[model samples]
Target: MNFHELLLCEGNTLEKEKGEHVFMQGDSDKSLYFIQTGLLKAYYTSSSGKEAIKSFILPNDFIGSLSSIYAGQNCSFSLVSLETSMLVKIPFEKIVEYGKKDIVLANNIIEFLMRLTLKKERREHEFLCMSAEERYLALIESTPILLKKITQNDLARYLGMTPVGLSRIKKRVQSKMSKQGENNP
Candidate 1:
């Protein structure tokens, strides 16, 4: 089942401008959000204020401080819009209230949460095992649309590479693609 459908039916819709923070680090809000349009980035800020991009959330994806919500603590990461966006914001309390009355909704929420966890785990493994070029190529293969939507700096950060490094990878990939096209032609 599409989790966004449930969110759209039950949650409050909110519009966010580009560069706006949906929820900042250390925020106490436990509201979950489903992106309906545009892009968002989840990031971590170090004590020295260096930002590290964790993930770029696209439309139909969910974003929130999951660990914080589970732990009853403040959010550890901030979610900011990379473009003007629309989102369905669902309060955690409301989810519990609704879940008590609906078993299917409860199961769907559990399944969605599990899928998120598994995706994160897969990404972690990829980072540990994949070269920077391989990681970038995999991203291109999986989410090419993101290349158009996100800034090079943000994409570099998401792939755990410097902007210059990412540039080199892009050049290499493009050159390879061009060579393949010429050969086929």
Candidate 2:
């Protein structure tokens, strides 16, 4: 069964409106959430109050304070819905209980966490190696759906660029594609 199905079997679900916070930075709650519908963003706020988006969680994505759960500390980031969303809220204690009894469920959770970790590592490498334009282009190529769903400001923050920079990159890429299409046709 899929992650959603697993969560449905074991967790409590809730509906959240756009702009609602699932959890805030420094929150002590260690609940794990699986998105049933819509989108959410995880972000970190610096002491100077600048926000940096960590990731966009889509349907079936698992999110929570994994590090905090393991370390027994407060959550390090904040989670907020980008649209009206449905989520399965699984308490950390429940996960532990399920893991102890269900090998398949435990393995699936491990795989999911590993995939998330790899994706984060890849994004870090891309940020370190790619130019602003290249990063935007790569994101568009890899996750075109995000272009339709996310706000320009949020997208820019996720890409580690300014809104103006993202705009310029989009215009440039569009112009380049248009020119290439015309020449090919």
Candidate 3:
């Protein structure tokens, strides 16, 4: 079954504004939220008073349910709407009952979790292996739409770079692209 149908069957839609939180770290782990529209970022603040992004969720993606899958654990990450977003919140009991009743739904949920995990892992790896410029380019190449939607500061934080460093990289990338265009012309 499709996402809307699933939501229609057993979930409620929530509307939230940009900068509003869907869930915070240490909140109850009783529900799974699916993004029907817009975006959400999962993050955690360190003891050093730093915020590190864990993952970004776009439309048709799931968030916050991972910690609940194995056992009901306190939220390990904060989920904030990056834009005014629409989310379908499904309670754990509803999903568990639905999964038991329908194999296809269970399979879909499993696949969704696996997809999210893989993407999160890739993001972590990029932070480790890619230079700031490379990571920035990769993000741009993958989600050019986000360039207009999110602030450079958030982008810098997501890429694990300082905002000033991001500014320098942005200028360099722009200059390089402009020169390439001139040369080609």
Error of 2 at 126 (Å): 0.9
Better of 2 and 3 by lDDT: 2
**Which residue pairs in candidate 1 have backbone atoms (N, alpha carbon, C) closer than 3 angstroms, thus clashing?**
none
Clashes of each: 0, 0, 0
**Tens digit of per-residue lDDT, candidate 2, span 78-135:** 9999999999898878777877787887887788889988998999899889998898
Which digits, one per residue and each the tens of the lDDT, describe model 3 over residues 98-171?
78888888898788778867987988788789898999999888989878877887788888877899999999
- 1 or 3, greater by lDDT: 1
A best-first ranking of the candidates according to their lDDT comes to 2, 1, 3
Best by the TM-score measure:
2
Report every candidate's CA lDDT: 0.86, 0.87, 0.82
RMSD of each: 2.9, 2.4, 2.6
lDDT for model 1 comes to 0.86
Q: Which of 1 and 2 is the better model by lDDT?
A: 2
Ranked candidates (TM-score, high to low): 2, 1, 3
Question: TM-scores of all models?
Answer: 0.87, 0.89, 0.85
